[model samples]
Target: MAYRTWQCENCGFLYEEEFGLPLEGISPGTRWEDIPDDFVCPTCGFAKSQFSMIEI
Candidate 1:
């Protein structure tokens, strides 16, 4: 599986994980493409573009 990194729009929280099925209680059957571009940050409800991909 491929790994992906995601940044938080609110507090700039960077998170990384393997690409696979979504975790329980967080997202249901959520794929990379399925995620909405206007998705809001869980902590501060910021827009999706506010998040940046973290390159390792």
Candidate 2:
């Protein structure tokens, strides 16, 4: 699978699908689409809508 990286528009926090935020309860390999809508950025506490898919 091609994992994607999502960036927080508020704080530039990167959420890599290949390495989910385990400390935030999101397991590794979790897909971006699978994440809940209510999920917030761990760094800035911004909503999921604040994130944008980033190509790397």
Candidate 3:
């Protein structure tokens, strides 16, 4: 599956779907939109609303 990447608009933190956050219980290949809304930026405390699809 082709995974996409997202960037935190608040902090420029990148969340790559190919390398899911194990600490957050998100397995690899998880989609950006599939991530729960409660999930916050690891670097900044911004919510999912602050993230945008990014081309890497």
Candidate 4:
């Protein structure tokens, strides 16, 4: 299993998810790759590029 750290592009909010948090927000059966590009940051509205992969 690979855990990744994702940061919000706008507010820089950091969140760690194993399978991956849902683009619509933390929910059941959420995959990182499944997240939509338009997914806005909970803290700030930013695109996926704003987020980067981090070593856990």
Clashing pairs in 1: none
- Model 2 lDDT, residue 25, Cα: 95
Of 1 and 4, the candidate ahead on lDDT is 4
TM-scores for candidates 1 onward, in order:
0.55, 0.93, 0.88, 0.60
Residue-wise lDDT of candidate 1 within 10-39, one digit each (tens)? 698544445332442235334445566766
RMSD of 3: 1.1
Clashing pairs in 4: none
Number of clashing residue pairs in every model? 0, 0, 0, 0
lDDT at position 28, candidate 2: 96
Ordered by lDDT, highest first, the candidates read 2, 3, 4, 1
Per residue, candidate 2 scores C-alpha lDDT tens digits across 3-53 of: 999999989999999999999999999999899999999989999998999
Best by lDDT: 2
* Runs in model 4 lying further than 4 Å from the true structure: 19-25
lDDT of 4: 0.65
Per-candidate Cα lDDT values, in order, are 0.59, 0.95, 0.90, 0.65
lDDT of 1: 0.59
Top candidate, metric TM-score = 2
